[model samples]
Each structure stands twice: as structure tokens, then as C-alpha cells.
Target: MKSKPSGTLSARHIVFFVIAAAAPLGFAVGSIPLAIGRGGIGTAAMFLVAGGFLALFAVGYVAMTRFVPNAGALFSYISAGLGRPLGIGVAFVAALAYALVSAGAVGPFSVFAEQMTQSLFGVTVPWPVWAIGGVVVMGILGQLNVELNMRVLGFFMIAEVTVLGVLGLAVTFQGGATGLSLAALSPSTIAQGQIGVVLLFVFAAFAGFEATALFREEAKHPVRTLRRATFGSIAVIALLQSFVAWSIVQAFGATVVDVANATPTEMFAIAARNYVGDWFANLITILVVCSWFASISAFHNATTRYLHALARDRVLPAVFARRSQRTNAPWVASLTHAIFTLVLIILCIVAGLDPYLDLFVLGSVPVAVSIPAMECLTAIAIISFFLKDRRGLSAWVTYVAPAISALALAVVVYLVLANMEFYTAQTGAINWILPGINLVVLGLGVSRALWMKYRSPRLYEGIGRYGLE
Candidate 1:
């Protein structure tokens, strides 16, 4: 067996990786318009609210590093606090969420890539071809050193941020169409929209930060790096997203809500073209593709790591835990993830689903369900862990903070459930059906854990035994 790679990732590497998973440009081009339409001027405030909740969650999350250190992320934390049975259940939930979202990106990536290819070089290729091409590229990258993937993501991350930053600054300096007002941040403006739906979008935007702890085993200084990366990623994403949203509001002035409602999908690109130039808008379009690629790579890394962690703990086939002798990458797990996503893409094509609408929307539903569920679980795990075993930690760090975070996440979950129709924009059975599928997945996970406990008690005992590596 090849030795596992260790101490190869810095805080910066982890930070960029998490941000890439969040896919700032993709959100800006895709989801932000929807957020603006629904939340109106209060979009920025919702982001801050989401950020605060995550920050509080991070307080206990990072503190867990002092005791539980494993790449299983919420799995390990839950097992430590809750128990191995529940931990195993969450492992499946996390895998399903990450895998669905990762695979979901291929659709958008292919759609945009095909469009850009035809527009730029006049070469007309089918969307599936571009998607398969991305699968090939991502698979190859997945088998390389973790640092190599980090560098690739870093470059793409910088490009995505730079383009948006330029557009944001341009709008800021020009004083927008509204001439710089704080109305967007006003209480009345925030109250005007459906805060529940807006909060769901806000929470979804911050989904990737939890991946920070997933890199614990590879981080140079696991404790410090995890803490810094988690907090930093949340802070940066919140501020950047809020600032960009505000810039758009300023650009559209009094008509911002109307424009967002009318052109939720094209608002950002239109804003870029209007404020910057056609050239910048073109650049933004290009970066949107790169943004998807970066996100795919980031999500690939995360999903593979989760598989590796499970396999390492004997929950999955040990072959998945195998590392490449040369690069020390989780080659088996990466390949498995790649093949899985490729299959999903093929299925979508066969079904004749719209990549942007059907694929992305349905794909995101699992993620929306899984992430908040995990957050709420993790927060409860934190409180439960500290309550049972203080381990010399402060009450605020372990109890108060996590309790507040849990309450916030509970609200998020309620909001998501209450507004599923608005959230998915799908009527009829699909909305309930998609979320129901998640529950079935969770049920299977829990059932598997209970079976393991009864039939293979010893194996179940090792569910979340961190520090094994």
C-alpha cells in the first residue's frame, strides 16, 4: 500500500479550495440574481446573517480540533459527540450531498463551455461532449498531488475574483445609478421580501466552508490552519458577496428589484456590460466557465476525501483509501467520483433535461438539504460533546456559541422546508419528491449503522475513532 500524504496543504491552500468549492463567480452569475429578486435590497444583510451563524458554528467546530481530528469532518465530530451510529448516518448524507452537487456542476459547465466554444471559435460541439471532456480533465487532476489541484484551483479562483472585483469597483467608484445609499441595508427594505427564502440562498452560498475541516489530515498545522481557513473563508465570501450585491443594487438604483425580477439570470452580466464594458462582460462570461471548472475540481477533491476517510475507517471498500505511490493522491476514490459523475451526466443527457434548470436545480436540492442538516447536527454535536466532556474548554467556546449556531441553523432548515416550492421553483411532485429522496438516503444510512451495530459491533465501534492515522 502507498503511504498517505500528510502535511502538504497550507491554510492558504485550504482557503482557496473552500472558496473554489463555493464558486463565487458561478453564484454571482447564477444565484445572486435570484437572491436579489427574492430578497430585494436586503440580500446583503442576509449574507451577513448567514456569515454570523457560520462564524458561531465555527467556534465550536474549530474547538473540536483540540479533541477530535479526522478528515471525516461532521462524521467525526458527530461520532465524538453523538455516537458512531449517528456519525455513520451523517457520513452517507455528506457523501450524497457533495457527490450530487459536484456532479450537478458538470451540466452547467458543459452548457457554458459549449456556448462559449461556438461563440468564440465557431466550433459547435454538443453539451455532453464538453461535459465528458471536463470529466476527463477533472479525473486526471484528481489523481495528481493535492498541492497541484490547489494551485490549479488557486489560479482559477483568483481570476474569478479579479473580474468580479473590477466590475464591483467600477460600480462603486461611479456611485452607481442610485448614487450610493444604505437603503439596501435598511430594516424596511429587508422586511419587504420573503426573509425565509433569502436566508436559504444565503446559507447555500456558504456551503463549502465546512470542507475546511475535511482537509485536517493534510493541513500543515491542523488546528491553527483549520481554524483560520474556516473563519477566513466565511468572512471573505460574506463580505465579497454582500459588496457585489450592493454594487448591483446601486447600479440599478430604484429599478433594481424590477430588473432583478425580470433578468435574474442575466443581471450580473448585464451589469458588467453596462458599468465596465462589453470587453469586461465577455471576460465575465469566460470566467463563469472557469468558475464552474474550479468548483468541480474543488468538489471533486472534497468528495474523494470523504470517500477516503470512510474507507480508511473500514466503512467503505479499503480500495478507496488507496493512495498513489508517486503522488500520494487518493486515486481510487477520485476515479470513482469521476466515473460516478460521468454516469450522472449521461443520464441527464438521455433524459433530455435542461442542464441549467433540471440538472442544476435538482442537483442543488440534495446539497441544500444535506448541508443545513449537517450544520445543525454538528452544532448539536458540539454542545453535546462539551456538555458530556468539557476537556478543559471554556463554556462560551463549547456551549453558548454552538447553541446559538444551532438555533440559527434550525431556523435555516425550517425556512428551507417551508419554502421548498419557492426554493426549487418546481410545482407538483418533484419538489417534495426530491427532498423525500434525501430522507430516504438518510434513512438508509441510519439503517446501515444500526445493522452494523447489531451484526458487527466491533466494526461499528471504530466508526469515528479519530487519530487512527
Candidate 2:
């Protein structure tokens, strides 16, 4: 008989993996500026709010792990609570969401890498060349042992966080132009501008925390490890992002919003140059590249695992479930994801889309829509599962927490849709088109689930069940 992959991940390994997926440095440098501009000084509070909602979502999520320990995470949880058909549908959404986000990182990574190389060494490389190179490296890593990828991600994650930490400290101690204040955290400040718009970016930053549950099968102590990793990732990301946003406010003083609005893209880099030095600003640029690389690798792993779970259930081709005999890696699924990303990158090149602006914006739309929808559905699943079979679980742990999370996530979803124009900065058909595409993806998933139920009832029954062959 063939050996199955054994659990090797500890809490720390899972934590690093999810955090790397969050890509703190890249999000801060790339996305936070727009967040600050829209949310103003209160942007820090928005992160806290978003984190709180996610933490509540984790409460029931981790509780469900006791009953269902499938690597499919959201798929398994939703299926166990709702039904096999919904679970199968969720599996499709999860795979597509992660894949879209991962592919989105490619454009930014290539663009940043090209910019850094030219600025630092006077070498001008095309974005596609850099993108293809990154894909090759990520593909190689994704097809190896999970532990090996974790180790490499650990190095990049630490470096990315450390650089941000140093910059935060520098800004705090030196006290920007206003000399440090609680102004950003004030209720009035947070209510500034269109808060709904800020919520989109804040929620997007927390995209990878759900990945904790996805590693349940590989985690050493699935229950405790998943719980700790989930809560810890949310807490760390929330605190770190909040501090960094406040630091930027301090650096710019009362003019923080004006500056962010004026130079939305270069706001963070400019802050680094003003507070730290040219050398540190240059370092931030390089770390942005590393951060994107870490994010791509992290999401590639996530996408393959989701595909692996789907294949195992016969939802996808059996070939996707093939694992390496030596490393136990989901080699076929990994390769498929790599190739899928390359094809998209090639399409972007052929269409002559701007790497940072057009490709990144379009690629991010699906993930931004799908993730919150999945979270909301998962929360409902938790409530449903617990209500049907309490299994001695507390009401607060199962029902109350998830209910609150669902409500909060539903609001986030609404806000994301409401702010689609702001997100894409497009005025007409494109705005509706981006969201319309996501609805189609969701429709496809539901239709496939219904098809499976009628055509293959037995296979449908195994949708979210753990240990199914």
C-alpha cells in the first residue's frame, strides 16, 4: 500500500505559513496607502475592527475542527454543517479564490523586482521575464516537501516582519511630524471619509488567516495548533498593521490624509525615506519583492492543497491527487497551479496590461469578492453544524460567535461590492464586470454541486468527510 502524508507541522510552522501568505510588507507598502487615503487617520482602527471580526469567526471555526479535521478547511466545515453539495461548491470557490490571489501577486512581484533591480544595479529587466523567473522558483518550491517550503517561508517572513518592525519603531520613537498621538484611534478620526471603502482593503489584508484550517491534516496537533495559529495570525496581523498605519500618521502629522491622497502609491516608501534614510527606503523596496515572493509561494501551496482535496473526492481529475513518493508533496496539483498562473501571466503580457495597475487590479477582484463570501458561508455552516449536533459544545463557542462573524462578514461583502468602483478606479462597465464574474464563479460551483448530487450521489456524500479515499 502507498504511504499517506504524515502530519509534520507545529503551531509555529502553520503560523509562519499563514503570515507569509498575508505578506505584511507587501500589503503595507502596496495596499495600505490606498487604505489610508480612503479611511484617513482612522485606518488603524479599521484593521482592528477587521481583525476582531476574523477572530470571532475563528472561534467557531476552530471548534468545528474537533468534529471535522479535513484539509479542505472551509469546504469540509461548510459541508459538515450544511450538506455535501454546499461543501463541494465551497471547495470550488476556495480553490479559485486562492488561485486568483496567488496569480495576482505575480504581476506585482515582477514589477517590484524589475524596479528594484533597475534602481539598485542599473539593470532594466522586463516584468514578464522577472515574472516567469519567479514562477519557476515558486513552482520548484511548491512541488517539494511542505516542511522545506515552510523553512524557506520562515526566513522570508521573518525578514519582512523585522524590516517593518524596525521602521515602526523608528517612526514611534522619532515621533513623525506630530510627535505621536492617539488621534488616529479616535472615533471621530475613524469615521472620516468613506469607511466602507477602507474596510475592503483591511479585510483583504486578512485573507490568509483562514489558511490555518486548511493545514489541519498536516498540523502536529490539529485542534490546538489550528486554533492557536488562527487566533495568533489574526492578532499579529491586526496589531502590526494598526501600528504601521498609526506610525505613518505620526510621520505625516495632520497632513497624513492629504499626503496619502496625493501620493497614494508612494506613501509608505516616502515615509521610510523621511524617517529612516534613503538606505532603509531602498531596503523596503527590496523587501517588498521578497514579500510578494513569499506570498506567491504561500498561496501556491494553499491552491494545490485545495485541488488535492477536490481530486481526492473525485470532484476534479484523479491526476490532481497524485503525490510524490519521496516528498509526499501534491506534485501534480502544484504543477497544475504553476502552469495555470503562467498561462494567465502570458495572457496579461499579450494583452499589454500594466503589471502593477491593470493586471493586479483585475486579478484581485475575484479574491476580494470570493474570500469574504466564503467566510460568511463558513460562519453560517458553523452555526448550523453546532445547532444540529451540539456534541456538548458551548453555545457561545458554536452559535453566538459565528453568528456575529457572519453578520460582520456580510457587511464586509456589501462594502466590497459598494466600493467596487473605488477598488478598480473604473467608472463604467468594468466595475460591474469584475463583480459579475465572481457571481458566475459562485454559480458554477453551486451548479457543479447539484450535478454531483444527482449524477454521483455516493461521491457527493464524501465531499467533506475526512480520510476518504
Candidate 3:
């Protein structure tokens, strides 16, 4: 039998899925500081700004969800609104974007796992060994029911948030290194350093925004669950991230830029040392590893789901569509993702690539660009979908909100392109080449879809349909 959703998941469950996918501790230790180094204290506000914009995007997105419910959210949404051929093209991009993202998470998970283990227990393990180990664990989990996955993610998430709470509150109560200051949130202080690159970091935090839609088929009251989960995830992360950034600011006070620029990746470590203690700093490092594992698991789920959706429609081998009836796991698709992860890690290792620099950033950052671009395309498709009939949705829901989202996301795509070096950490041919992978795959998908349209009408009609009820 074809794999089917268990239809037991809920909004709260999906929220964990989304938040864990974004990996809060990992971002605070990683991306947030990068933004601070560029934008000064005002960078914190970008969290709320990005959240509000996504919430607005969700208005039309959720409406479209009710209008066209399916598991392959981006794929089905585009197909329902636009035509199937274009939908297939975007589906291919979305699939590649997410698979690349999943593999990207593995590289760093391995790196930090190696670091964390060696530091905590004084046992040395090679990063490539740790990388394969992560794939094995995540692959097994990916083949189980999502509830089990949520539980595992939930434990790590709680630990992450609890530790983060300590950092923020400790920084506040301790009156900071230079006294408590609200300047980071002040409207007067704007992001000044390479604003495009800074905002790219901010927008990328919401990368898992599509998680809500993708799990809808399994969600009870899918539309209601989607609306609540989408808004809830964005709001939670925005507020949590802002609070964390505020703490980091308080920890360093005016020296935020100097510290961030000097250390880059050590922002969290430095802050923990200042306000909390070395004990807390060490704990943060350990949790950072767990956080990355959560991220890998979350993205692994997304990648496998994409494979299952495509495989079920014959865009891929049908064997990949098989699922565990008892587990509700896309077992075959999960295996496919595990194999891809293994191959990617091996290829990077063979090339003697730095896991974080050459592997993750190159593989993952383009996803930040391409997914937002795909989202822009989906926003436009929503307008097109509702063009003939509003379905009684307000002009705001059908047109206005979507128009704003499309324009904003289009601007985002441009920003990523303009500041490619800042985002990818490379110059010259490789920078463009990394981003070019998205376009090349996009063209290939479009071409194959056109071929199906002419040569196999039956298959063309089924693209992205996914047996949605």
C-alpha cells in the first residue's frame, strides 16, 4: 500500500517540528551574532520584523492551504494555483533545496559533535566518523512515526530553551557587563553594516516556515492546525530570538560589534562566560551539538517527505514511496535521504573540504536564497489561483497580502544575489556556482516536466497532485 499520513499530529506537534528545524541555540551561537557584527544593536528588531512579514505571508498562505490542502505544501500549492508543469519545476527546486539543507546540517552536526565530545569527555573522534553516525541515528528516527520524533526533538528543545533562558535572565539580573540597555530594540538604531547580508541572516532564521504546510495531511484539522502552527512558530522564534539577542547585547553592551567581529562564532560562548559562567558556557557548547542534531533530524524529515511525495507521483522511483504502515514512516524515502547524506559527506571528505566552510555553508546558504525565491513564486501562484474566484476570501487575503509577500520575497532573492559573498563566504566562480546549482536544477526540472507534458499526459496530470483529499 502507498504510504499514508497517520492523521494524528496537531498544531503543537508541528510547532516543535518547525522550531527544532530552525535550531534556536545553534542560531544564537551562529547567525545572530553575524547579524550583530554588521547591524549593530538594531539587528535584534529584525527578528520581529521578519516574523511580522511572515505572519502576513501566512494570511494568504493559510487561505491557500484551506483552498488547496496537501502534504507537499509548496508543490501542491503551486500546482493547484499555477499549472502542473511550472509546479513540477518548483517542486524539483524545493526538493533539492531541502535535500541540500539536510546534508548541510549533517556536516556541522558532525563538527560540533566532535568538538563537544572531545571537550566534555576528552575522547577524540574524527568529524567524518561523527557525521556518518549522525546520519545513522537520524535515518532510524526518520523511519518512525512523527510523534516519536517530536518527543526526541522536544527533549533537546527544552534543554536548549532552558539554558537559553538562563543566559537571557542572568544577563538581565546581573545588570550586564555595561548595565542593562534597550538600545538594541530602539527604533533609532538601524542595521548599518552591509544591510543586505545582515537581513539575509535574519530571513534565513525562518527557513522552516514551510514545515507547517508540509505536515498538514497528517495534522488533525489540517487548516486550523496550519494557521495556528504557522503563526505560532514564527511568533515564538521571533520573540525568543529577540530576547536572546537582547541578552547577548546586554552581556557585551557597546562592545557587541567588536566582540562579534573578533570571534564571529564565539558570541554565545563569550556571553555565557561573562554573564553566566564557564560552566554555562561549556553547557552551551554541549547543547549546541544536540541542537544541531535536532536540526539534522528536522531537515531529514523534510527531505524524506519531499522524496516520498515525488516518488509517489513517479517523478522518482516508486520504491521510494513505500512506508511503514505501523510507523507511518516513509521508510524508503528516509533511506534515500540517508544514502544521499552519506554520499555527500564522503564526497566532501574526499575533496578534503572543511565541513563547516566548504560543505555546510556552500550547500545550505543557497537554500536560504532559493527557498525564499520559491516562496515568492508560491505567493504569486496564490494570487493566480484565486484570480478566477476569490472563494469569498477578502481582497487582502487573496491579493493584497500575497502581493506584499511576493514583493518582499522577490527583494530577498535579490539581496541574497547581491551579497552572495557575505552569505556564502566565498568569492569568484564558486560563489555563483553554488547559487547556480539551484537554477540548473530548476531548468532541468522544467525541461523534464515539459517532456512529461508532451510525452506522458497521464503522468503530467498527476504531478504534485499527491492524492490529496
On lDDT, the candidate that comes out on top is 2
> How would you encode candidate 3's per-residue C-alpha lDDT over 182-256 as one tens digit per residue?
888875665444567667888877888776888877887777888899999999899999899888888888788
Arrange candidates by TM-score, descending.
Answer: 2, 1, 3
Residue-pair clashes per candidate: 0, 0, 0
Could you tell me the lDDT of residue 178 within candidate 2? 66
For each candidate, give its TM-score against the true structure.
0.96, 0.96, 0.96
Cα lDDT, all candidates? 0.86, 0.87, 0.83
Worst 10 residues of 1 by lDDT: 1-10
The CA root-mean-square deviation of candidate 3, after full C-alpha superposition on the true structure, stands at 2.6
Question: What TM-score does prediction 2 earn?
Answer: 0.96
Kindly list the per-residue Cα lDDT of model 2 for residues 1-469, writing each as its tens digit: 1224458898899989988999999999887878887777788888888898899999998888777868899988888888876777777878988998888899899999999999999999989999999999989998899999999999999998898889888988897786789878777876765788888888878988998878878877778888889999999999999988888888889888788889976887888898889999999999999999999999999999999988988888889999999999999999999999999899899988887787778778878888999899999999998887788878899899999999999988988989888888889988778767766766777788788889998977777775644
lDDT of 2: 0.87
lDDT of 3: 0.83
* lDDT ranking, best first: 2, 1, 3
Residue 263 of model 1 has an lDDT of 85
Error of 2 at 10 (Å): 0.8
